[model samples]
Target: MLDLTKLAQQMQGISQQLTLEATATRQRLDRAQLLMAQANERQADLVQMQELWRDRLNFTAAMPLESLDTRIEIAAPPAAHTVIATDGSQIAPSHHEIAYCYLINVGRIILHYGQSKLPLLDSLPEVFYRPEDLYVSRQWGIRTEEWMGYQRTALEAQILAELAQALTDEMEAPTLALTDGSLIYWFLEQLPAEARDRILAPILAAWDQLRAISVPLVGYISASRSGEALNFLRLQSCPYLAPDCMTHCSEVVDRAPCQVLDPLKDAALWAIRLEPGQRSPLWKSSARIQEFYGDHAIHFCYVNVGSEIARVEVPAWVAADEDMLQSALSLVLGQVQKGYGYPVALAEAHNQAVVRGGDRARFFALLEQQMIKAGLRNVGTSYKETRKRGSIA
Candidate 1:
């Protein structure tokens, strides 16, 4: 149990830190705007600087497209449009469990507004216990959660692709598809080359399906903490010609010129750059994982949908097309308005996919029952697990 008294003692310090940060952020926002203007005027220079720095640039920064300060009012959504979203939940495998297995459930939601068809809400659950399924990651002793997360992400994309492609072919009006988080598979960068390839295969295939069908696919993140745009803006104000952190910052203790914008994130910065129902210009992500993504490299923009700024990401294919990009943001804004600041379809997809504590308990109980029915003994059942459960208060 958490010690309330200890937590309460630190609460005051936390509050003080927040106050100091907020004050500093206000100061930085002023400078950030000035630097943004300077940077916008030199987009070509900044792009060149990125190329010159290339592999040496320590920070992951975004590339400005045309203008950094460009803001477009929310597109008037089509009268009849469809928005579909998919979210995934997983039960990671554990040795402490009765069954050493994992589960992935993808929740699919399709909401039709100003159309005759009723909403579609369903979930697809899959279990993995086979040796091939359990050890797909190729890591000897790494934690299972990371591999499970990738599997769930792939499943969500595949299911969303099937739904979106069918709807795009069938419907006359525009159709949009959304996944809960980013399209950038940044996590895969940490894995071995073979493992990364194995995991990314299905995800790229799913993206190809939607791309072939010309269905706009989006990755939605609410109150995103992505520092891509903020990091890019910081480059404009760097004191050094090259902004080489490794060589130049060896003697500097603190970020004298750049730390002024330390507290700002993409969402917070875009909030100042945009008004309600407006979106900032698109920017391409510079994550190293993009090297592997190739044509599906991720691009993103910030949208102020009344309550807060939300980050919306898309594949390179969708981002390059003006009509498709506008249709996506407009429908996203409409969904946010309907849900009162969040996407309604994504919200419902989460509700259908979430695996709670009680559900986890029942799942293990069912596993134990099935093992007993199969006339097999759970010989390696965890002793510490039972001890923890039966401990006297």
Candidate 2:
């Protein structure tokens, strides 16, 4: 049981600390604007920074932009456009269980605006028990759940592509497909080469399908922490006098410029700059995985949703198309407005995908019954789990 009085006291103390941090954060944001304003004069520094550390750094255009400023005019979406979103939830494998099993639930919602009565909805929950699905890497003894997350991401993209492909008729309204997080599976870098290849191949296929269909699919990241823009600011502080930093600052410690902007999230940085419905200029990602993206390299932009800022990622094709970009921006903003700062389709999908405590309890009960029927050792509940289940009196 929680100590109510103590918990309240701790929360109050946390509130005070948050207030202090918020004040400091505001000051840092002001300083960030001043530093970013000077990015142009430091173009030579960026060039040097790139030349010295091209392999070490990840940048979209090979060279950091001389200016950190880009603003695109927001255009309203068509009244009859459709927005589809998918979200996923997972149950990780437990060692206490007889068999290593986990579940992935994907929920999809298709919302048609402008007098469309039919809104498609579906949810799929898959259980994996195959030897290949149970273990990620036998050599490393890693759990399959670790890699399943990336697989789920790929599955979501594949589902979106399938849905997009199904829309064969050319309607007046454009259809926009959305997923909850980044399009790039950055975690793939953490996996072994074989694991990465196995997981990424299908996602690559999905990307090709979406690109061939020319459908605008977006990966919406809320409160994004990416700092691709800050890399330019860091370049501005390059201390090297020449195009190569190998000799000058190589031995120096923590000399990157714009350390003042450290820990500032991308959404927070754009919150003050963009108006509601307005979008920042497209910024290409410098992720190493993008080398495999072929013509579908990922790019991102920040959108101002009035209540909060959000980072929206799209493929290079969508980024290059003004009509598609505007439609994505407008529909996303509209979705946020309908959901009160979040997308309604995503919210509904999340609601459908959620796994409640009651659901878990029922699942365990069924598992126990199955084990008993099979004449297998019950391996009764863990002592810790038993204690947690009891009520506090």
TM-score of each: 0.93, 0.86
Tens-place lDDT digits, model 2, residues 96-132: 5545678787887878889555887887788776877
Candidate achieving the largest lDDT: 1
* Alpha-carbon local distance difference test for all models: 0.84, 0.73
Q: Which ten residues in a row have the lowest lDDT in candidate 1?
A: 136-145
Identify the runs in model 1 with alpha carbons over 4 angstroms from their true place.
3-6, 138-141, 244-246, 250-253, 256-259, 378-381
lDDT of model 2 at position 128: 75
Question: Candidate 2: which pairs clash?
Answer: none
Per-candidate clash tally: 0, 0
